[model samples]
Target: MITNETKENYNQCQNVNCSTTFVSHETVARYIIKPQLINVLIPNG
Candidate 1:
C-alpha cells in the first residue's frame, strides 16, 4: 500500500548546502505533515 512518489511541492535536500543537517527529522516531519493534515481536516478551504 506504500509507494515511492511525491506530488507535493517542498524544498528538497540537494546535498549542496546540506541545510537539513541543522534541523531534526521530527521538526521536518511536522513541517511537512502538519500542513497536509490541516488541509485534510479543513477540506472546505
Candidate 2:
C-alpha cells in the first residue's frame, strides 16, 4: 500500500542497528518504492 503520498511519511528508516539513516527521495525510491512496485507490477511477481 505504498503511494507517492504515503511515501512522504516515515522519511527515515533510522537503522540504529546499522547506524544509518536513508533520507532522500531517490534513496527512498530505490529501497522502498521499487520493492512495492515489483509486487504491484501488472505482470505479477
Candidate 3:
C-alpha cells in the first residue's frame, strides 16, 4: 500500500507467524549535472 501524504510504501509479510511489516520511503532525485553530449571519433580503416 502507498500513502500520498508521506509518499511511502508499506509492505507486510503474509505469514501470520512472522507478521513482519516494512515501510519504504520514496523520493525523487534532482539532477545536479545534466547529461552532456559525447563526441566519438572513428579511425580511418
Score every model by TM-score: 0.14, 0.17, 0.36
What's the true lDDT of residue 25 in model 2?
Answer: 35
* Candidate closest to the true structure, highest lDDT: 3
Measured by TM-score, how close is model 2 to the native structure?
A: 0.17
lDDT of 1 by residue, 1-45 (tens): 122332333365778868453432222222444334344354675
Candidate 3: clashing pairs of residues: none
Residues 1-45, model 3: lDDT tens digits:
254334777899999999999988876556678779989899999
| Model 1 TM-score relative to the real fold | 0.14
> Which parts of model 3 are misplaced by more than 4 Å?
1-7, 26-45
Give the candidate number with the greatest TM-score. 3
lDDT for model 1, please. 0.40
lDDT of 1 at 13: 75
How well does model 2 score by local distance difference test? 0.45
Q: Whole-model Cα lDDT per candidate?
A: 0.40, 0.45, 0.76
Regions of candidate 2 where Cα sits further than 4 Å from its true position: 1-16, 26-45
lDDT of 2 by residue, 1-45 (tens): 255534333355557776555544322334443444345457756
Specify the poorest-scoring 10-residue window by lDDT in model 2: 24-33
What are the runs in model 1 whose C-alpha is more than 4 Å off? 1-8, 16-45
Backbone clash pairs for candidate 2 read none
